[model samples]
Target: MYFSQNAIILVMLMFVVSAVFYSTINYQTKAVEDEIKIKEVSIYEKNVKNTIDRNINKIVEDAFVNASYKIMKSRKFFPNAKVAVNYITSFIKNETNKSLKCIVGNSSNITFDVGSFDIEPTDDPLKIRVIGNIELRYTERLNNGEIVGLKNIQIDKEVKLSRIPDPYVYLNKFYYKWEYGRKIILNNFPNDDKNHTFCIILNDSNFNYNRMYNENSPTEIRIIGRNSSTGRWNVVLPYWVQTWREGNNHVSIIWVKVNNKELLNVSEDYIYLLYNSTTPVDREDPENTFILFDNFDYFDPDKWNESGEILINNSKLTVVAGAGSSVFSKDTYGEGYELMFRANFSYTPENNSESAGLFNKLDDTGGYGWAYYGDGDFEIVMGDDSYGIDNTFDYINKTYIYDLILNNISNHPYIEYNIYDSTLNLEYSKRETGSFDGTYPISINALPPENKTSNTNITVDWIFLKDVNNITATVGAENIQPITYTEEKPKTFNGVIYYGVGAYDKVYNGTYSIIGLFTNKSDYWKYPTTVGYKPLIEEN
Candidate 1:
C-alpha cells in the first residue's frame, strides 16, 4: 500500500475534510433539537399561566355570587359604613375559600390559597369595590419534566347591593330629630284645619311614665310636629292626658294640640310624642282628674258593663229597650261628687214604671236613684221611700242635662237635682234632705213599658263625675309639662347610628297600640341601587 509523497498527502487531506463535514452536520442537528425543546417548554408555561388566570376569575365570580346570596338572606341592619364593609369582607373571604377547591387544569397538584380582602367604598353609594390577593402554588408534570412555581394573583371586583332597607325610615322617617329616648308617634287624626286638638290612646305598659313625668323632664316630653312647609320638626307643646288610668292600658287618652301656621296633614305628617327625661312632671291638671268621665267616643270594655241591647253608636251610648237595657260603669264613685249626664229618648213610654235616667247603687238588685218615666213623671227613690213629680217639661225625643249633687252638710248627706234642656236652660230643679252612705257605681238604664216588648229606648251622650269626695273646679289644660331643651346622643345598634331614607317610612296608624305601632319592619339594610358584580384586572 506504500505510495509516492504527494499521493499520500492528498489522501490524508481527503480523510480530514470528510471528518469535518460530518462534525458540522451533527452540530447543526443538535442546535435545531435544542430550539424545539425550548419552544415546547415556553408553550407549556404559557398554557399553565393561562389556566391559572382563567381559574382565578371563575373563583372570584363564584365567590361574589355566594356572598350576595348570604347578604340577601341576612336580615340585619348595617349600623354604619365600617360595619357594612367588614361584614361584606368577611363574607367574601369565606366564599372564596370554599370556591378555591374548584380550580381546574390540575387534578391533584393544584393549590389555591385566598388571602385577606380589602373592601373600599366607591363614589357610588350603592357599589363597593373589593380587592383580593391570592397565592397559587401549581405543579404541572409533563413527559419532559415537572414545572413547579408560585403565582401571586390580584383580583379587583365591584359589587352592588340594593335590596336592603334603611332603618331610620322605620323610626318614622325622623331619627330623633326633635328628641330622643322614648317616642310615641301619632297620626291618622282628622286634619281639616291648621290647628288640631285630638286625643290619642296608648298602651300603658309600653311607656315609662316615671321617666316621662319627672321635673327635670317636666317639659322633656314634647309634641313635635313634622312641618311640611319647612321639612323640619318643630316642638309644638307638651302633651297631657284628658283621661288616663293608672293600671296597665286603662283608657290612657293623651290630648295633643298642634297650632302651627301650616295645616297639619295627619295623613301625611306625623306628630312625634317625644320623651327623654328622668325628672318627674308636676300634675298640671290635678283638679281635672275625675272619678269617671267618658264621652262614648269609643267602646272600652274596661270602662263599662252593659246588659241587653246596649252598644255605642256615633260616640253615643245607645240602650235599646227591647229587652230592658242598661249600662253601668265598672268604677264606682264616693259621696261628695257631682254626677252629670246628657240623655235622649227614642220613643215615649206608655207606663209610669217604664223610665230612663241615672241610677246609683250600693248593691246590684236594689239602690237609690232617680228617673224620668214615659208616663210623664219624674221619680226619686231614697232607701225604700219613692216620690214622683208630674212631668213639667218635655223629657222625650229630646236631649237633656241631668246634674245631680250628693254632698254632706252638717254631717247629713243631701241630694240636689238640676235638669236643663239641650240649650243648657234650666227646666227643673229639686233638693231633698237625706242621709246616704257608702260609695256608689253610677249607671244609666231604660225600662221598657212592656219589659221585653217595648220598642222605646234611651241614648246617653256623655257622663261626667267630679272628685270622689266632692266637686272641684273645672279642668282646663293650656300647657302640660315644661319642655326640656337638651341635646342627647341618639340610640345606636352595635354602637353605630344609621341614617334614614324617606322611601322606607311606614304609614302611621294611630289606632294601633304603642307596641304594634312602633314595629321596625325596615330592619334589613340596603344599598341605594340595584346589585351588580363585575371582575376587572388591576396592577399591584
Candidate 2:
C-alpha cells in the first residue's frame, strides 16, 4: 500500500518473496507426493512376498502329505493299506486347511521307511481297531537335544487277547514228590508283570493244540499291545521242555546232549523232567510209597523229597568219556596190581576148576567180586573188565572173569546195562579165585574193547542194589543205593543188554519203531528214534 521511494523497493522485494514462496510450496508438494508413492510400492511388495511364501508352504505340505500317503498305502505300513494312509494323514492332515497338504509332502520326503516288509491290501486296522493309550514315553534322546517317541498310537481292534499261564515251577506232581524221591523247587515265572505285558494266547498252533500250553502246557500263546513305544510289551518266544536248565537255558542243553555220550551217568542229577508226546516225553518218576520200586512212574516233585529241599539246576551236563583218570579211586596192590592196569584191554587168568568161576583164586578181601541176581538166581564171582573201563589198576592181577549180558536189551541199542541175572553165576564158567587185589572200591567189569564200537550205543540205568554193601554200577543224583530202607530188601533194576539187528542197519543199539511198539529180535536201538526214554519194566 505504501508508494514512497523505499516503498517501491519494498514492493519489488515483496514480489520476489511471493514468487520464491510459490516455487517452494510447489516443490514441497511434489516431493510429498513422491514419498506417498514410494510407501505404496513398499506395501504392495510386502504383500506379494507374503502370498508367495504362503503358497509355497501350501504346495510343499500337500506334496508331503500325498507322498506320505502313497508310501504308507503301497507299502502297507499298517495291517493294510487302509490303515497305512489313514494313520499318516491323521498325524499330518488338516481338514480346515486342506491347502496345508504340502506340510505332509515335505515331511514324507524327509523321512525314510526302513526295514519294511511285504504288504497286504485287504486288512483294515481301524475298522475294528482299539485306540491305544497315548503312552508318552522316551523313545530316544539325541545328542542335539531332541526327544522322539511313539505318539498317536492305537491298539488294533481285531487283535485277539488271552491270558497266559502262570509261569511258576513248583514241585511237579509226577516228576519229583515226597514219596518217590524228594520235594523239588522249580522256578516260577510270568508271575511278575511289573514290566507291563499283555498276552494273546493263540488257540491254534501247528502242533497239537491240546498239548501246547503255558508252563502248564496251555493250548496257545500270542502277542498283545506289542506296539508299545517301550520295551515292556515286546518279547521273543522261548524253547522250553519239561526240563529246568541253568543259566545257559533249555536250548543250549539240548545241544550238549547231542554231543556227549558219557552224559548218561551225570544226567540224572538235574534231569529234563517233562512229558510231551510230540518231542519230549521225559516225566518224573510218579508212583512211590513202595520199597521194591516195581514202578518208576513219577509226576510231582513234592512226593519224593517230603522233607528235604530239592533244587533243580539247569547246568549243562557236559560229560566226556575220559574226563578223569581211568582208574578212579584205585590203589595199586604192589607190583601185581600194576599188571592189571591197561588203557584199552587187560588179560585175566583162570584158577580153581569148579570152586572158582574160571578166574584167579583170590581171598574174599583180596579179589573183586560182584553181587549178581538174575531170573531169581544169585551168585558171586570175579568182576571182568572188558567194556570201556580203563584198567588203571592193571598193577593188581585180576583173575577169572565173570561175564554179564553186555549187549543191548532186545530192542534198545543205546542201553547195554549189566544184566544181574547171569552176572555173578560162578557155576557156569571156569571158576577161579585169588586174582583181584581189591584196589578199586567198586568192581567195574567193562565190556571188552573189541566189543565197543561206535555202532554200539551205551545206556546207563540205576536202581538201589538191594544190599547194605551193594551199589549200582552207575551213580547219579536220582540213582543211589539205599543205605537203610524202611523195609529190609532193596530195589533191583533189571536193565537189558542187546544190539540192533543187521536187517535194517548193521548196528542195533536201541528200539527202532517209527510208530512206537515192541516187536523184533533186535536187542539194540537205531537211529532217529527216542530210546532210553522208558524203563525196562513196562507199565501194565
Best by TM-score: 1
Weakest ten-residue segment in model 2 by summed lDDT = 164-173
Give the distance in Å from residue 110's predicted Cα in candidate 1 to where it truly belongs. 3.0
User: What are the per-model numbers of colliding residue pairs?
Assistant: 13, 118
The digit string of per-residue lDDT tens for model 2 on 352-386 reads 11111112221122233332111112233434432
Give candidate 2's root-mean-square deviation (CA, Å). 25.8
Candidate 2 regions off by >4 Å? Answer: 1-276, 281-326, 330-440, 443-540
Best by lDDT: 1
Candidate 1 ranges with C-alpha deviation above 4 Å: 1-91, 102-108, 113-116, 122-126, 133-138, 141-154, 162-315, 328-334, 347-370, 375-402, 409-414, 418-434, 437-441, 450-452, 461-466, 469-540
Residue-level lDDT for 184 in candidate 2: 14
| TM-score versus the correct structure, for each prediction | 0.46, 0.18
Error of 1 at 496 (Å): 13
